[model samples]
Target: MLIGDVARRSGVSTRMLRHYDALGLVRPTGRTVGGYREYSAEDVRRIFHVESLRSLGLSLKQIARALEDPAFTPSELVSDLIRWTEDRLEREQELLGRLRTVDASAPTGWQDVLRIVELLQGLASTSAARRQQAVLAQAEGVPVPAELLAGAVLSESDPNVAGALRWALARAGGDGVAALTAGLRSEELDVRRRAVGALARMPEAPGAAAALADALGDPDPTVRRHAALALGGRGVTAAVPTLVAMVVEGSHDVDAAEVLGTLSQDPDTEDRITTALADELAAPTADSATRIRLTQALVELPGTTAQEVLRRLAHDEDRAVALVASAFLGLIREQPPEDGHDERP
Candidate 1:
């Protein structure tokens, strides 16, 4: 086949074929009567081979080396192609995500588009200070979209930046909640924790509250504690058991106790709160230290039931638990009964 015939048959442009010949890659095996380049069947096959390699993301030079150099093993070249493809794919995916975030923002003009892009870039910045400033700029009336803030919140490792992201999301209102909910379902433990933490700080809208309620069942203890504490403060008695468990485990037990105390203001939940603490205290598996923390938590609960439980714990078998419970009971007794109701009603 002549160069024109080869171009027509193989879909390789004639100009590209000439470039291939000039580069000494797939030169024709013969010349026609008019001195036009003519390709033998073997040369045509080599041309197809070159195109095949190019399709696999091989540089033309790499393709020439692979075809000409007997020692040029394909293993290393293939690995390099894979790495390059992966890097390109990652860049494309990141660009697509940015575009989607911008589209979600529904920017009205180039200025709005630029502001959103800059905020998105800032949120993804290496410096925590920059990320925090991006979030705070929203407070200063920058139009950072809620979806971007939610994404930042989920991925932010720095505590301060994460807090600012959550604050910005809260102000952004319900738009961030959907992204946060998706983060809650992420298999990554840290992402789930961050999602729950952000949701916990948000206003107790039905969506956020529901997401946090689901997070109460998260496998991570940090996630569960954050969710449970937030729910408890919102008067969700479902968090009472987890809050009591927190006291037993001595993980954020003080904050857990305070939320529990706040939940106990309702007459219906006060007994349940007392019972949860009593059960943890009486559990056979609870060690001395666990029992002591549980005793301290009981002090946060009001009502005669907690007092009665504390009175029994004050003379318990463990010396440390007994001494702590006795001290707590003494303080409860010394404080006027009216003081308890004064704080509640």
Candidate 2:
């Protein structure tokens, strides 16, 4: 077969075949009557082999080594090809994601497109400062796609940057909730914590409260604690037990106690919160320190029930518990004469 016939038969262009010949990749073995290059059957087979290797992302030089070098073991070369292909695939996937984010933004013009790209790049930057700046910029009207913020907030490790990202996500509202919900289901505990944290910031977003409520049962105590605090702030009485548990565990227990106080303002839930605290106080699991924390948490409750609980605990068997409760009750007694009446009177 002549070069033209081989090219036509193999789908390799004649110009490419000539280039392959120049590169000594697949030289035709004979000459036609016109002195043009001619290909024997074996040469045609080698041409097919080169094209086959090329299809696997082999460079021309690498293909030459693969085809001609007896010392070139395919194991290492194939491994390298796999790595290269994976790298290319990862790049393509990243590009596709960026394009999707841009498309989702529905950019009005090139300026909007550029701003979104720049902000997206910043969110992915190695520097926490840059990521934080990107979030703040988006908050100030950078038109960043909400999904991009959702994705960033999940993986952000820097406390400051993650806070900024969560703030931006809250401002972005309902659009980012799906991404955050996906984060809540992540296998990594840190990721789940971050997801719940961001979702907690957007309590008013559709399903945000529900997502946090679900997170209340997360195996990670930190995740559950955050969910409980957020839910408590949102007046979800279901979080009372977890909030009381937070006070016992001393995990951001102060914040948890404050949120519990807020939840207790509702007459319906005040008894529930105080009851859970009293139960935890009486449980055998409550060590001296646990009892102390629970007693302090009671100080946050109102409507005289907490004061009555303190009066009862003030005479408890544990001296430290009695002292703490007595001290709190003392502070309550010292504040005299509200609305022209004193509790002592």
Could you report the Cα RMSD, in angstroms, for every candidate shown? 3.6, 2.7
What digit string (tens of lDDT, one per residue) describes model 2 on residues 63-176? Answer: 999877899898998998899889999999999999999999898899889888888888889999998887787636655667888898889999999998877777776898
The number of clashing residue pairs in each candidate reads: 0, 0
Once fitted onto the true fold, the runs of candidate 2 whose alpha carbons sit more than 4 angstroms away are 138-142, 266-268, 303-307, 327-345
Off by over 4 Å in 1: 139-142, 284-296, 299-302, 310-345
lDDT of 1 by residue, 129-224 (tens): 998887787536655678878888888899998887777788778888898999999999889989998888884754999999898888888999
Prediction 1 global C-alpha lDDT: 0.86
**Can you list the residue pairs that collide in candidate 1?**
none
lDDT of each: 0.86, 0.87
| Residue 3, candidate 2: alpha-carbon lDDT | 78
Cα TM-score per model: 0.85, 0.89
